[model samples]
Target chain A: MPALIEAKNVTKIFGGGLLDKSRTVALKDFSFQIDSDNPSVTSIVGESGSGKTTLARMLLGLAAPTEGEVLYNGKNLEKLGGSDRRQFLRDVQVIFQDPFEVYNPFYRIDHVLETPIKNFKLADTEKGRRDLMIESLEAVGIRPEEILGRFPHELSGGQRQRIMVARALLLRPKLIIADEPVSMVDASLRATILGSLLRLNREFGISLIYITHDLTTAFQVSEDIMVLYRGSLAEAGDVDQVVRHPEHPYTRLLVGSIPLPDPDLPWEGERAIGRPAGELGVQGDEYCQFHDRCPYAMPMCVQTHPPLFHTHPNRVTSCYLYRESPELPMPQMTSIFKSSNREGPPEETEQLDALDAELEVSQENSSTPTSADD
Target chain B: MVEETLSAEEPTAAELKETLKVEDLHVYFHTAAGAVKAVNGVSFSLKSGERFGLVGESGSGKSTIALSLLRLIKPPGKIEGGHVFLNGTDLVTLTEEQMRRKRLDEIALVAQGAMNSLNPVRRIRDQFILAYKDHDIDVKRSGLEERIGDLLTRVGLNREVANMFPHELSGGMKQRVCIALAISLSPSVIIADEPTSALDVVVQWQVMDTLRSVQEDLGASVILIGHDMGLMAQFVDRLGVMYAGKLVEIATVRDMFGDPLHPYGQMLIASLPSLESRKARLEGIPGITPSLLNPPSGCPFHTRCPKVMDHCSSVTPILQEVRPDHWVACHLYEEA
Candidate 1:
């Protein structure tokens, strides 16, 4: 069977138009397939400008890739015929990051829910439309009475987002692209939204493409996770294998950065602040994008970008360390748990007055004219 | 008025002098519909150099409390009753001019969405200069140019960034610049509202480290307001849990996370998906946040409290000491 959605060597370049000197490679030679037959959640996890949003847009057919094709059901998304295109549009839906912005403040709440029903012709009668709306809303744990005759301003952010989910559920979309759906929502309420998505995936067998920078939530919801670093694929594979045992140095950094809830498990060593973003959007194809920040980077990484190499049947990592024969000596790999922060008994440093006096002297020195030269 | 409102117990001579104290604050928004009690009778104290964390869902008055501290609450939303003390001096009695001077000099605020807080039209250096001037400091006489460079480097930015406008910096960079500006004067107290919520995890870590290091360098107390329980656990010395315009619990960070006394605090910690323990299901607190315009009668959390009782609707719960250094406002823990 043809995949529901597939990106074949997709690349997106922004601002390289006729008169523009600047060019940004949002996604570079990226490819992934969401199988149609088997419905499961696929997560594209990356930081800002890593091209997760661009990928979501391409999959939704909202934007065309600059260099490659996005295939829907084995047919190019751009080339789909009238009915096929409509079908494709109806099948793939998006849940945006901010719920407040997605909704129109002027309209009544039902307008958003009803528009999908009317456009898709899911129901003919008013009663039928109402019933469908109620059913969809109920599926997302919202009652009809709660949302009935309410304006967009009447609902909370979580409620507004749940309504969006319900509106998408009304379409019975085969695939849903949730781009940071829970990022705007509170942590206490995130479980409800995530739970709703998981239930839909299981009960209705809907394929979900969860795009987010949050790795922990991605681990919770996604079966297959793709970690992106500056538009290049860092690692891709089973979430358990990838997250539990992240292969890439960037992926390890990402895993280590997650703030664990345990107070007992404080950061082991001194936390290192990230280097300032150095010359974004202008890297040579051969140069590894993560070289500057990668602790395990070798001299070869500056000369050549490592292609995706299979570490196991279930995992692929783009790193020279995983290579069979590396010219440079491998940097010692630190265990994320131990190396994340130096392991020590939590310090009971009560001598702040003494420290403050020292800090005061240093502060005065730094402010002095002579200190600048020194 | 401050003395009358404060409970009978006096501060012991041995007790540490609080860097900032908020006592029984009530800030309401006088909207057309009705007065929305955004912050109702909330109180907490920050000892000098303590990093305090406030965690709650949106519309739970966390930001309002932060705003209330700075007296930044605009018209139609006013602090109805409160005593904000800095080293035992009441801020509520200060005039506009006095309050203005107190801001940035004594208590600095790194507001939420600080990237957007920078003036789009102004250069970074001008903003810093303007802030110093607003606090009645002559930037040129103080050699603020060199100080600005030092501040930028302290937050991991180049001195050259002072020439750039807000548009020139990345979100994370802009946030660091805001931190730099906040700490330029080395204020006694700093209130950072959702400082890292917008940044990526790695960048968030970096920003947090910068803030921590900056706080340590200045020996300044910090009140970090964010909803991420995990980040709060790692960052703060004490945790204040707010809900529906009131602080429902206050405890040390270790106690709050190790064994939360309040039901809301417990559910909040439980709802979060911990990397350490991937629990099969997260028991998210039920119901949406109550509308502050017409909140529940007795306890704000009673509407959704898992251990709610019939008496919960009639009697308001006061934050009482449930354990040594831990306070909870639930009726379940109320003393006879």
Candidate 2:
């Protein structure tokens, strides 16, 4: 069976001209797929520079990958023409992080629901279109009377976000890529917004790719999760296994950092890890990207990057500690770490302290905008 | 100190002194439409070196109360009636000049979005120097740099960060710089409004850890205002739940998390996604927050309260001690 959407070794590199020496690898050699037959919710978890958004853009065909290709229905996305392209556009919809920015201030909320119906020709008559709009709005639990004639600013943040979900439902897409949908909403309304998205998969038979920096929400909603670290896949597996028992050092740190809502379980015993300072992707791609901040960095990690090794059933982790597992395909690299003298990992406290000083000096030359825009 | 006094079952004269006390505070914005009571008759007190969290949805007056405490509300928005006692000094009655002098010396503010609060054109050291100059602190030029460096080190940043501009640092580093600046005066009260809301989870933990350490070192009471309940549960000693300009519940963190008394607090706590157990369906609070312009008649949360009675809409419930230390403003706990 052909995949509904697929990314084959996708890579995205931003900036770096003949004159410019600096280039940022937003994503590196990443591959993913969503099956057409099975509807599932997959979460792409990452930090600010983790390239989750870049991957979403490539899947939507908004941006082309520097090296690999995105395939829709087993055909290259860039080469699709006529009906195939329109079908792809209709089959996959998106809900952005900021709900307020997506709507136009000049028009009423009806403009948002009406344009897609007219463009797609989802309804034959005006009455039919109005019925479809009301059905979609009711599906997301918004009363049409209170919402129809109001301007975008008149609605609250939670209401606006629910409207965005309702608009996506009008298209009846097979897959919806929600990028931090509930991050901006208040704590009280987050569960409501997330519940609507979950209903799309359970009741409406739509697949979903939830992209967020929050692991707790991802765990609650997704069946499968992919942890991204600086544009590389750190861990991938079932959400239950990965989040409950994370194997990758980065994944473990990410899961451990979540502040549980129980006061009895205070965050204790975990030493604070200082953030590494420097431009991402500046480190040589041949070495493990996480070795600098990783607590269990071995000598081999500094010499060669580790590939994703199958650690358990339905689980893969990119760490040298699991290199000896039977499922490792690269047999030649496994022996290299075993032969190295087992010395205690270099004292990280002093190195981390030194890096803090270096970070201040290195950032002195970059002219990034400050919080003046806020 | 107050904890020890409470444990003895008797309040001594010295330990009875609260670091900060707010009584019947009312903040209103006089707009063309009407008077929006942003904060109405809210009263709370902070013991010395205690961490108190004020949590609510948007427009719940959490931030307004913070500004009111510091006398930072501008025109159109006025402190209609209130008394903010800081070390027995009523800030509402102080003149403009006196209030200006009192700020950063007795009370300080670590505003949200640290990048916006710091000047882009100035180096980190210059901003610290300007703060010192504003309060007229007498420190020699040669020792000023050392003092700034020491403050930076206390917040887990390198002393060399003082020479770098604000734009050069990352988000976490910038917040640490803000935390360092907040403790420079060693003020008795520090109001940090959503200090880590803009940061990533990993960076948030690091920054909160830094804030916790520096706050402990200074032994200053913190008034943390935010909407994140999980963060509040973990960081604060006592939590206050606000709804439509009113504090509906106040209790120790453990008690509030274990057994929330008010319906609003219960719904808010139940809505949070927990790592320990995943529910099939999360029960969110029904209905939206009422507008402050014309809030609900008597009890602000009566419209959404699950156990609301007939009198809840006509008569307001006063916040009273339902348990030993837990306070709830609900008719369910009120005596006839």
Candidate 3:
């Protein structure tokens, strides 16, 4: 079976003109595939400058890659004919981060739901369009009675986003590119919007490209995970395996930063590898992008960039530690000690223990507020 | 000698008295639609060095409360009735000039989207100087650069960052600058509303660390306002769950997370997706927060509360002490 979407050794470079001297590589020889028959969810997890957005834009055909090509059903997306382009658009849909921007303030929510239905001719009559709108709206947990004829300002952010989802559902696209869909929405309503996307994935067999920096939510929703670090692929594998045992140093940092909900399970040990300061993407292009911040940075890391090594059957990590042949006994976390000889494990543990034992009590607990002063 | 004499009596007063105390605070927005009760009879207190979290979804009036604390609520919105006692002085009754002086010196706000709070046109140093001059700080023109550099370094930024414009800095850097500025004056209370909401996770961790260290170093109370329950669990000392302009529950982070008493608080905690556990779907709180213009009679959350009783809809429940430090405003726990 042909893949639904495939990126073949794609690269995107920005700014190499008079206004800009240094070129920023948003994606470096990136390649990935989504099987059309299987149609599962894939999360492109990355930080702010991780080039996940660039990949999404390329996949949507909104932006072209500098090299390689994004293929849809074994056909190049850039080379698609007018008719094929229309079909491709119908097959693929995008849900943006901000819902407020999706709709106009002057128009009613009905305009959003109506456009897709009218353009696609998903329904024949006015009654059919109304029915389709209601069905799609209900699918995203929005009541047509409450939302119809209501302006964008009248509805909440979550409600507006659900309407966007409902609008997407009206097309019944084969794939949905949701770029931080729930990040802008409040936490309470986050699950509902995410649930709707999951429903579209499972129930409707729609493949989803869920892009977010939040690993926890990505792990919760996606089957496959792709971890990116400053335009470079760090690790990619099954969500369960990758989240449990992240191989890449950048992936480990991302996973370690996730704050757990349990108060007793305080964040301790294995701090995030801080981003190296001064001029991003200015480091040697041949060297490992994460070498500066990697806790286990080896001397060879500066000399050569590591290829994507298959650590497990499903897991792939682009790190020198998991190289095919031994370079230097997989550089231990000795670099930290080498940099700061005074600081050791004992002091770190002591600080962790003290922080863990810090009381949840406030100073006002022992004394009452001065309400009498009023 | 004079400074030593004044500082001698400050320790006991700081320890004994609350840094910020808000009692029966009510703020209403007089919109063309109607009177919107943003905050209604909400009372909470933060100690000198306490880290307090105000958690609620959009329209829960949590942000409104934060704004009301700093007296930043603009027109159309009026402070209806309340006593915001910052160091035993009722701020509601204070004159505009007195409040302006008291605003930055006594209580400062690191407003939500603080990255955008900085003027893009001006350099970071000029903004810091402008803020410093507003409160009439004694930093001379020559020494201001060094002072700005010190503040920038405290927030983990390089001294050269003070010379750059807000546009030159990334979102995280801008947020750190905002954090640095909020604590520059060494205010007694810092209301950081959604401080890390817009930043990346790793950046958020660093920004949070910066806030904690600065807050500790300055011995300032922090009112951290955000809807991220997981973040609050790791960051805050106390948690307050708000629903429809009322604080439904307030307790230590331990008790609130371990055993949430109120239904709203319980549901809020249960709804959070944990990173450790891979629960497929979250049991989200049902129904939207009611319209504040004409909120539901009595209990605002009764419309959505799973453990709703007949009397809950008709009678307003006052916040009562359940556990030693835990307070709940639900009728179900009234007898207990």
Candidate closest to the true structure, highest TM-score:
2
Ordered from best to worst lDDT, the candidate numbers read: 2, 1, 3
| Proportion of native contacts present in model 3 | 0.46
lDDT of each: 0.78, 0.81, 0.77
True-vs-predicted CA distance for residue A175, candidate 1, Å:
1.2
* Model 2 per-residue lDDT tens digits across residues A218-280: 987776788999998888877778898999999888888888888877664234453364423
Please provide, for model 3 over A51-149, each residue's C-alpha lDDT reduced to its tens digit, 9 standing for 90 to 100. 999999999999899989999988999999988888899989999999979888888889988888888888899999999999887766666777798
Q: Calculate DockQ per candidate and list them.
A: 0.23, 0.26, 0.28
Q: Candidate 3: DockQ?
A: 0.28
Q: Over the stretch A103-197, how does candidate 1's per-residue lDDT look in tens digits?
A: 88899999998888888899999999999999887777676776767787767677788888888889888899999998888787687777677
Model 3: runs farther than 4 Å from truth? Answer: A17-19, A268-284, A325-374, B1-16, B141-145
Q: In every candidate, how many clashes are there?
A: 4, 0, 0
Number of the top candidate by DockQ?
3
What is chain B's TM-score across the candidates, in the order shown?
0.94, 0.94, 0.93
Residue B201, candidate 1: how far off, in angstroms? 1.4
Q: Is the docking of candidate 2 incorrect, acceptable, medium or high quality?
A: acceptable
TM-score of 1: 0.88
Distance from true location, Cα of A361 in model 2, Å: 56
- By DockQ, rank the candidates, best first: 3, 2, 1
